[model samples]
Target: MYALLQSTAVAPNSLTVIDFLADFVKFWQIIVFVFGAYQFWANRRERLAADKVREAQELLDSNYQAWLVVNSAQGKGGSGGRIDALTNLARNAQSLAGVNVDGAWLVGVDLRGADLAHASFKDANLQGALLSGANLKHANLEGANLSAAQLEGTMLQGARVSGARFSAASLLRADLADLVGWREIAAVNYARLQEIQRAPHGFREWAVEQGAEGNAVSEDMSAENFSTQFRAV
Candidate 1:
């Protein structure tokens, strides 16, 4: 205690004072540095958030403009614009529900997982197009060519496919027959579960033989009543 009092009793020397001042300066420098770093990080986060919102809004604006082109680009000499807009919408996975593009040439367009509910593609050429996992509920595909198209897991429950040939196309696990508008509507889900269209080769053949039908399942066939009624359910 006496030694400590002797060291601190009098004012410290110039060296001691300089050392204390240096430590004080370093402590505040660290505080200032930490505060500045936090501000920088916070500012960076705000900028990133703003950029994300801006990008989303820009995308929505683009889709809206494309939709405008799709609706207006009809009648004659408008297929080019319509096709481009449709392609953009499809690429963006936008809904094409109830949008009519009759007789448009959209061969090889990529429409995977697109929402095409109630869309009219009558006489549209979609040969070799990618339509896997697409929603085609109540869509009109009369006279549309879907040759070599991919329809794996596609929902086609109420799509009107009259004159639409799925020749060489894939229909793996696709949704079908809900458009039949059956009295037993609950059975529709079960029917979709055991889709005869997606049957094993042997099972399909056996069912065909049991039904005494030909190998070809016509698009005009009513799968519900096992009749030859085409168009609406």
Candidate 2:
């Protein structure tokens, strides 16, 4: 009779130990599930970001290829219509970050609102191109042909413009602060000189010394009439 009573007491203790183990296991399982879910979320976000980068790279590549085709067709004396079509494709490309279009023939291309920060356009022909609202911060424009290019509201801070041609280029509301080699551009007439907004310290004095004149030359000119009376001097 005593043995039977001891057995019954030990059974309850065993049941309690089993219940604790089961609960512990359940807790660990929940923790593992939460950790797994977090890992999945983190990985998914990383993948999405990588996908965006890839997409941007692909777009840039397409533009580059189209530009090359245009150049090649021109070199071969091909029909102007085909070259124009290819040029249009290149011009309308989106997300051109970190692209290298150095020495490219991109004359008259529409690059408005492009993300061209840290891009290389060295010796590229960008004459008459629409570059309004483009982000050209830290871009390399050395020896590039920018004559007659539309640069309204363009961000050119820290851009390298040495030996670049800005003759006849519209710089209305363009940011030229902290630009590298700003004094070495090919030309800076009154019209181009008036486009500078928040011009680097002493740049206004330098422009005045360089013979720029007109209503846009004053520091207190109304914004509406600032570039309206711009005349090359």
Which structure among the candidates has the greatest TM-score?
1
| lDDT of the candidates, in the order given | 0.65, 0.71
Off by over 4 Å in 2: 1-93, 211-214, 217-233
Whose lDDT is greatest here? 2
For model 2, residues 1-233, the per-residue Cα lDDT tens digits are 99999999999999999999999999999999999999999999999999999998977777777656554554332233333544455367545666666776767777788788898888887767778899999999999877667788999999999888765567778998898987886665544555567787877676556644323545543323433333221
Candidate 1 residues 13-121, lDDT tens each? 7668899999999999999999999999999999999999999998899899998887775544326677668778988878788888888877767888889998888
Worst 10 residues of 1 by lDDT: 184-193
- Summed backbone clashes in each candidate are 1, 1
In Å, residue 211's CA in model 2 sits off its true spot by 4.4
